[model samples]
Target: MESAPAQPGTAEWYLAEASKLRLTPLDDKDADPTQDPKFQERQRKIVDLATKSVALTHKNPEKKQQFEVSARYLLDARLQLAMTGDDEQVELLYENARAFVKRDPASHAAAHGAHTLVNLAYHNATQEKAPDKAATWRSEFAQLANHYLQTFPREEPRSVPLAYTAGRLCEQHGQIDDARACYTQIVQFTPDSLHGSEAERILRRLDLVGNPPPISGPTLEGET
Candidate 1:
């Protein structure tokens, strides 16, 4: 016999409902779908379902997988809403990420949440015109990067890219000390890798007042 469907209030039901509401193709590629009533309505439903699923699985240890899945969906839905230029959703995304990381610091979803924050920081810095907001995002990015580094070991694959991004952003914003700290971590952890080599070059450049000399090596004939 076939099994019955998940009950309406259960986590599985919410996830199923959310999965059913896929975005359809738009007639105009350049048109902003977020402005369409149908699109907005669908997004709202998705956000609602994802939020409910997270709540349902919050304290259920046996439902840890479901919780992570719900958190991912929640963040994704919030990100979509935030892309509509909704400040509320953007703030909620930050809150959601923080909460998720706090609840499951070592989970893949937590890492993704941190990465999402980094993306938001980049968007605010490059795309938005508000300086104060951009600064706030940068600060948050630095904080998240530090937190990730502290939480995950250097051997973790995600660590290197996060360190690189954090270092570059810090250097760009004149946080030389913070940048050096990040780059130093990369160099110490993986000195032979591409990121480590690049980090070493950056550290060398930072040590000088002006641009450092070009990197040269001996050719086959031993010519400099």
Candidate 2:
């Protein structure tokens, strides 16, 4: 039988539990759990737990850096949860992301936290019903995506996803040239990799044959 959900706990306990969840695979029986509601629920729960853990670390300076790392995990998991289109849940998740950034501005944590905001903004634009709000979110996404791409360390392995995210954000906002540049970087940096393959598909979709139109001297605000 499956186990019952855990009760919320102190920072140390929550952090430990979240760490275990992070290390564990979603399910051994299912080859892919991406579409599994149970998987998502579990992920959401784990992220919530992580947020609680972050809360406990607020007063401990030694744990502040650790909170940054946990925030990344929390934000990613929260985004996954938000994909279910649970509006109330998404609102809380957004707040959680905001709290994460406010708590720690460490570069690594901030990068991941920025990615979380991008996901929320994109979700608002594409999935929500409010046009004005959607436009606002898209605008935010564009700025966040650009900043993430520009600031993240190019040599780090983590740059792959950040670049891909920037490309997708540009594509969604109709900044074709900027999107292409970001995608092209992924391809050039790691041609045979997953992100590179996805980037190539985006380029093909944009119908650009060569060099992505040169990014065009900044000012990559996208169409609403």
Q: Which candidate has the highest lDDT of all? A: 1
TM-score of each: 0.74, 0.55
TM accuracy, model 1: 0.74
The sequence of per-residue lDDT tens digits that candidate 2 reaches over residues 112-161 is 76667666666666665776776565556556555555555553365567
The candidate that achieves the highest TM-score relative to the unseen native structure: 1
Candidate 2: how many backbone clashes? 0
Model 2 off-target regions past 4 Å?
A: 1-10, 28-34, 119-141, 150-224
Per-residue lDDT for 89-199 in model 1, tens only?
A: 889988988888788777767777776766666556555567776666666666666556556663247767877887898789787877888888788877898998999
Clashes of 1: 0
Model 2 residue 89 lDDT? 68
Candidate 2 lDDT score relative to the true structure: 0.68
What's the lDDT for residue 43 in model 2? 85
